[model samples]
Target: MKIVIIGAGAMGSLFGGRLAQAGEEVWLLDVWEEHVAAIRAHGLTLVDTAAETSIRLNATTQADAVGQADLVIIFVKAYATQAAARTAAGLLGPATTVLTLQNGLGNAETLAKVLGAERVAVGTTAMGATLLGPGRIKCGGHGPTHIGSFSGGATPRLHDIATIFTRAGIPTVVDNNANALVWGKLIINVGINAITALTGIPNGQVMANAETRELVRLAVAEAEAVARASGISLPAADYFDQVAAVAQATRDNRSSMLQDVTHRRRTEIDAINGAIVAAGQRLGIPTPVNETLTLLVKTLEKTYLV
Candidate 1:
């Protein structure tokens, strides 16, 4: 398949590199000129447990240069979803499938508004990667990726997309309840992200201490209540336990939120914890923890020069 990866950040590079390595026609598209230029010059350098290898692929900042694509996987930041989708219209063909494997909530909805709901899908991934530098990324963790139609149930395209992703070595599954999957991801991020971002600690570090663990649990509890009110049945009943397991699995790795803070970049707090707060208000569920965390993270962002 000819795929255009919009955003081309850490996760984008990893997925595009793996798919390209699997022999798909993959293009990495991003506004980061240094990253795109480096990929053009040296290929995309991927580091994993076994070895570090550079995977050759196409890349460009100008979407018009690529024309139409079979699939457009968006991995852009939550704030830039609309703008990025608007800028990449040249890459969308009539049959082009736009999949959002992005963090936070409402991303698929944003895509649906721009690309038409019929051509868009929602996805959540547990695969983790870190951008070491231009054209270089370290994929340190592997986990399942779930995808489904924006129309709310799994369809044939979900399986087809899952097949392509799995064939590229990204273990994937088709979720009939894509919104629930997204909520599950939001709960996980709500439980872990802001705490890690504020403390400058690895994911597992939160589980090591009672105080930190309690904070994570409370945050998660608030989100779980909101999820239930929204009528989304999460895959796991013990949501806090699931978050802990995820933190344990990716123990040493820093979260995307933490990385954003370290780089003084904006975070998806408004979409993660902030989303929960909005839902809580709309549904009459008080989400004090999520509300506070959202405020705190936004305050921290204010301190940054960027």
Candidate 2:
């Protein structure tokens, strides 16, 4: 498959490297010039727990350079989805599939605005990554990845993509309700990301304190309420338990938001928690905890490395 990965950061590089190693024709397009240059010069370095490997693939800072692709996997921040789509439009063939492993809600809608819903797919991944340097990322927790059509159904194309991921060693599944899948991932991000970024703690450390755990719960509850209010059914019945389980499973990992803060890079706060706050406002669902967390993360972003 001719694949182009937008926003080749940690997760992007992780997937791109794996697919490239699996002998797929993969190109990584990102604004990270240094990373792109490093990958172009030395290949992408994927550091597993006890093993290290590199995959040579095409990479460029300009999306137009990639020509056309059979699939476009979006791994960018939610805030950059539309811009990435716009930049990537030149790379989309008539039958190209666009899927997002991005966190947060409304990514499908944003992508649909650019490429139309017929070409868009929504997805979430449990796979985690830590960027050590340009062209280098440590593969953290490996988890299931789910992809589905934006219209809440699966097509043969969706199953084909899932099979590709599974063959590359990343377990994947085709789901029906894309919104529910996005929200299921969003619920976990909403509860964990902002708090960890604020407190400078890992996922396990964040859940170790009772007060913080409740705070996570409250934030997730508000998000859950907003999801139900929007008439979206989430993946889990005891959603808070699912959040706690994620915290446990990926305990040692710092979330993407926390990684952004530590690196003094801009975060997807507006996309994750802030997206929840916007939905709550539109739906009249009170979300003080999420609102406060959003503000706190944004404030920290302003003050970081100043």
Candidate 3:
């Protein structure tokens, strides 16, 4: 399959490199010129728990250079979904499938607006990666990736994409409820992301600390209430325990939000916690904890962005 990864950041590079190694034709599209140049010149280096290997693939800063692809994976930041969708047009043919393994609730919707709804898919992944430098990334760990049609039903196309991903060594599953899958990942992000960014703590330490753990519990409770109000079924009956277990499993890792803060890049505060706050307001549910965390993270952004 001819694949184009939009973003080419940590996760994007890791997936693109793996697909390339699997002998699929892969191209990475990004706005980072130096990173593109580095990949074009030296290939993409992927470091995993097992070993480090470099895989050669096509990469460019321009979308037109990639032409149409069998699959387009949207891995850009949540705030850049619309922009990614705009660029993705060049990568889409009549039969192309656009899958967003992106974090947050509304990314698939944003893409569906620009691309046709029938062409979009929504899902989440547990795979973790860190950008080491231009053309290089460390795969922190691997986990299952779930995908579904944007319209909330599984299709043959969904299964086909899952097959392609699994063949490339990325475990994938097809889900019928897109909203539930997105919300399931959103719930975990809400409980962990903002608090860790605020405290400068790793996932395990954030849950291990008493005050932070309570904050996680309250924020997660509010998000769960909002999810219920929105008529979305959560992945787990006990979300707090689910979140705690995830924290313990990925304990040593710094969250994406924390990584963004430490690197002085903007975090996805608006998408994760802010999405819950917006839903809560529309549904008439109180989400003070999420709202507060949203404000604090935005405030934290201001401190560095200026």
Candidate 4:
């Protein structure tokens, strides 16, 4: 099946490269001109802990270059989701499946508004990646990716896509509760990512510091309350363990928020912490910790933007 991956950054490149290497028809689309040029001239480069590898794949800057595809994976930053979805409109066909594996909440809803719920799938991935250079990415951690229709139904095409990814060594699962899984992932991100950004530490360091660990727990608890109020059942106890496991697995790797801070780019603070706060407001739940963290990150953003 034809697949187009929007956002071609670390996670996008990692998945696109592997899928292309596995002989699937994959196109990597991004707005970064230089990265696209470099990939077009040479090939996408992947540097993992194991070894450095390269794969020849079609890469382009214009979204229209992707044409039509059987599947479209949106991997952009959460803030960029709406724009990406609009740009990807040119690539959607009658039977195309649009899947969003972005961080935080509300992405599927956004896509559903633009692309229709019947064609929308939402998911989460534990896969970790870092952009090393223009066309270079470091794949550092491995984890399962789950995809499912937002309306909680089965899609045979999704299963076919999962099988293709599985063949590329990325474990894939199809679940009916993908929205709950997304919330679970949001809980993990709200707890770990912002703390890492504020402290300029890796995930493990945040877990190692007693003060930070307590702060994370408080943030997670607040988010859990918000989730429950929204009628979402998160893997609460399992989510805590998953957070710890991710911290241990990516001990030396800085989080995406930390990377955003270092590069002076905008963090997904709104989508992460801000999402919790918004949900709380709607449900009359107090999310003080998440609100506090959201303000802190916005404060940091002002410093960088100024």
In model 3, residue pairs whose N, Cα or C atoms come closer than 3 Å (at least 3 residues apart or on different chains), thus clashing, are none
Could you tell me the lDDT of residue 223 within candidate 3?
92
Per-model CA lDDT versus the true structure? 0.89, 0.88, 0.89, 0.87
Candidate 3: 10-residue stretch with minimal lDDT:
245-254
The TM-score, computed over Cα atoms with residue i paired to residue i, of candidate 4 is 0.96
- Residue 199, candidate 3: alpha-carbon lDDT: 91
Question: Better model by lDDT, 3 or 4?
Answer: 3
In terms of lDDT, the poorest run of 10 residues in model 4 is: 233-242
57-80, model 1: which lDDT tens digit per residue?
999998878889988999999999
lDDT of 4 by residue, 1-306 (tens): 788999888889999998998999999999899999999988999987778887899999877667898999999999999998897788988899999989888899999998888889998887888788899988867888888888897788889988998998778988878878899889989889999999998777878988998898889889888888898877556556678887877777778888889889988999999999998998899999999999999999999797
- Best-to-worst order by lDDT is 1, 3, 2, 4
Off by over 4 Å in 4: 236-238
What RMSD does each model have against the real structure?
1.2, 1.4, 1.3, 1.3
